[model samples]
Target chain A: MPKRRKCLPCLSGLALLAGALLVAPVSAAPKRVMSLNLCTDQLAMTLAGPDQLVSVSFLAREPGLSMLHEEARSYPANHGLAEEVFLENPDLVVTGTYSLHNTTALLKRLGFHVEEFSFAQTLETIPGEVRRMGALIGQEKRAQAIADDFTRELETIAAGQCGKDPTMIAYDQNGIASGRGTLADSVMQAAGFANLAADMGVIGVAPFPLEQVIAAHPDVISIGAPQKAPTLGEFVTRHPAIGALPDTRIGAFVPEASLSCGIPSVIEAVRALAALRTEIAPCHGNAAQ
Target chain B: MKLCMSLILLVFVLFVVSLLVGPAELRVEDSIAGLFAGGSEAAAIIMREIRLPRALLGLAIGMSLGLSGAVLQGFLRNPLAEPGVIGVSSMAALGAVLVFYSGLAGSSLYALPAGALIGALLAILVLLAIAARQGSTLTLILAGVALSSLAGALTALVLNLSPNPFASYEIIFWLLGSLKDRSMEHVALALPLMAAGWFLIALSARAIDALSLGEEAASSLGISMSLTRFLIVAGVALCVGAATAVTGTIGFIGLVIPHLIRPLTNRMPSSLLLPAGLGGAALLLAADIAARIVLPAGELNVGVLTALIGAPFFLWLVVRARREML
Candidate 1:
């Protein structure tokens, strides 16, 4: 009973320390966090707890490309202007290093706590990104959980691949195609398909000649879903030439916005595409047939 | 007749050069084979689908600009009365922008011609109304400047409102013009309308020549003023509209060619038409070839070259017109 009695003060003292630890950093947990880039918006939204994220880039509100568009509406939006960043007075700012080099430089000059996510991120880097964002927002445990789940789910999807390795090309608007070193190329590989555009010596995104696309004769062509408004660039996707190809599965296979960036939601893209991969060119021949 | 034939020859030579020059260096034999006999499939697509359509469009659109310019100069009785000058091409660009970007006609190529034709017709009507009433050189030129800026502004607005980022980028193409990567589909869309324009302009040939001798004198010589006006308006609208629909607004071909080749002709409006048309083709083809060769990869917009050549020519025209008026 005396030993049991000592446990109370020890537990109370420990509780006091735990309370101090939680409240002290919780108070420091940036009152206003802002995202200046699309990819960072995805990471910040997923990792940050409720009300922790103050605003996201205006592009996040666009349904065509944003995975968490509904969640994005609750928060205010920023146009990635340095003045807006200063006005909002965000303790921490997140953005990609692709564009707005001047804004990033200016923000650094003004002594803002800025974290830059690289643009050339592949599937392998996504889990780390989730964890890193979690750490930034003082929600390390939640981020670790998301990172583990993302990694595990990715593995599960990767494990399901039968290695039939059907060829696919990420054909986009205006006859552009994603080649090697692009996220699409990595996604195709992870889903047990070869990127035909990459195989033909195309590096990064480039103009894919319609004739070459026909000549390569890929098994699948992944096109981005067209937006609500029309564009002549979409004609290449629906051209009679592309339609003429036999035994080809052409579509926005992984659903819109899934493969647009390297987010945890991209696991769904992989899962959906992995399912498609099995159906099209299954290792267990009789089962697929 | 000999000058006409030689001008035609120059156009033909430039046409061949246009086909020959591209980012893809097909051997002459391969290019000829691709154009005629379908040598290698790659060469064939490059020549036929990519370069052939571009070259053919160059020939046809160049002819249309020349023809329109010639006809406008003759009908309006003003040297500065080209489609781009008086806002016909700019209005047509606005029409094409409104229809294509608004998706009212869907993603069809026909939308371009449909919208552009309407725009050109409206511009012609407005200009004709102005010309028929006052018809002073200064008045007509000022009206044209106003129309061009208005149409240009509206075209820019439409493109800016367009959800497609690429559509906004196309503002440069509309204002400046280019013939790069034009397909046979575009050739199909524009050529027939332009040919009809040529025929209609040809029908008004004798009338324009007669009308050039002051409106009263020409009309007294058995010319129906209303019918002549209609033909000129419709003809210029069709040619310029169809041309702008495909190639965007290529300026100064009409202005410079007529003035240059008029000296070669007997100075009659009717006589100047054929030579002006041929010279326009030659100038446009040469410029387009230079456009391709200049950058090699990101080919210069042919309109940029035409403007570079045309803008200086235009300033000179202004100075000379002032001197002659004085």
Candidate 2:
């Protein structure tokens, strides 16, 4: 009877240890997070605690594509390969629903905790995404701070928009333009500018005719900066017809790598456009006012 | 004379049509006024900077290809000789792709013509050597096919290897040329080289006619074969290289135009050159116009339209050539 009583305490101790193991994952934040998508990489970089994010997609370091490319250098870069994920065995994996389809599936099948962010991001979704990434990485307070700042700043810019809404087109390489339902379109809207490509019935990223772009005579033509490597497609953006718009302001008004993704940092793009709007057509003594 | 006059009129009409047709639906009166009077700055830019360059490229590039094809067929004494069919255009495209994409000349449009000229020059030299060694038309054509396949594969490989992701998208442009978004800069880059090419080819007109009789007979006629060879080689290379540098590898204009015009002419190779050039300009302008009209948003590649017409014609020519051989 005394031996049974001693064994009872040991059995309960083992049960408590097993229950703690079950509860720990639900309570604690992931220590090692790997981001296999460019957009997710930025989110994780912005929200992750020190040493929390183990690796980011290699594209995160590319200055042309990543707004936080400078910060991305400190974190190790992954090529979004399944093999690397297997080797690294990060506690959490964040990727995009649009790409790395097989890797996402494989990771999920292998019983890894995977979170997917949608590629079709807009200004409205930015705060939600920031908070979600923050929650996932246990940086909710920091994420909430950034998310609130982005929302407040965006709202302030949108509120200041009045009077003349200058027409703009985010013309990219190969005569492509960001139109309706694109992040650039939403940014232009918040900045008090009409998206010319969207107004002309273009959807998403589509080839906007050069002649049409010329004929539209937008008040501003926002073009991408030339890529690090030269491309013939870049010439379309620099075509003389676009240059001939004497009244139209043509330049990379948006900061580099700012408009390519929908992150909290995209607030910078909206702020720049709003400043341009103030310069081009101020709200003071305007008809809309 | 009548054929030349008709071809001239056709080219003139097509040139105007090419200017008139575009994705922008400008009023005819407005377009003309914009081209000359600058009524609306937008219209003026579209007319001057956009449509004009595209139309001019269509005309000049077509002429270059046609003249080269006529000169090549006469010099080689092979009806099947053409820049695109014989892989000269493909090699020229490869050269341009390699030079421009490699940043060898720092993104200057001049790099395109420079590389293309060298590529076209090498191709012509190799083809000329093959033609000299084996007088058979089929052997020369087979060699051209091999060269074309190799050049095409290499062009794709180089583009794929480029550090710029957009460079790979240009593979289609390099393979199937497009005149979309061509500006005055492109015309400035290509026209002078092509004009020089035309002049050089015109210089060898009498020699190619003489060579039509046979290489031995031409030599006996006191025609300088070496000089003629140099002029023809340089001429074809420049014409095709410059055209391709701007427009990518636009196939079949060289092949189809000469054949189409030869029947209208007295069958003299020199006589075919002028008419072929004019006809080529008209056909290319028409094709380009069609390209703009067919799918106004994206626009079809001008090469796609030309190949559609030329590939069928090539098959027919091959069959006829085979029957003649039999």
Best by DockQ: 2
Cα deviation at A274, candidate 2, in Å, is 1.1
**Number of the predicted model whose lDDT against the real structure is largest:** 2
Please state the error at residue A122 of candidate 1 in Å.
Answer: 3.1
Q: Which ten contiguous residues of candidate 1 chain A have the minimum total lDDT?
A: A18-27
For residues A126-244, write the lDDT of model 2, one tens digit per residue. 99999888877788899899988888888778777677688999999999999899999999999999999999899899999898988989999999888767899999999988988
The residue ranges of model 1 lying beyond 4 angstroms of the native Cα positions read A1-28, A81-90, A98-112, A148-169, A179-181, A192-221, A236-250, A271-289, B27-47, B131-135
lDDT, residue B140, model 2:
84
Task: Spell out the clash pairs found in candidate 2.
Answer: none
Per-residue alpha-carbon lDDT of candidate 1 for residues A7-56, written as tens digits (9 for 90 to 100) = 99999999997676445544577766899998899889988878778789
Residue-level lDDT for A251 in candidate 2: 95
On residues B236-315, what C-alpha lDDT tens digit does candidate 1 reach at each position?
Answer: 88898899988888888888888888887888899888888888889988999999788733468799899898889989
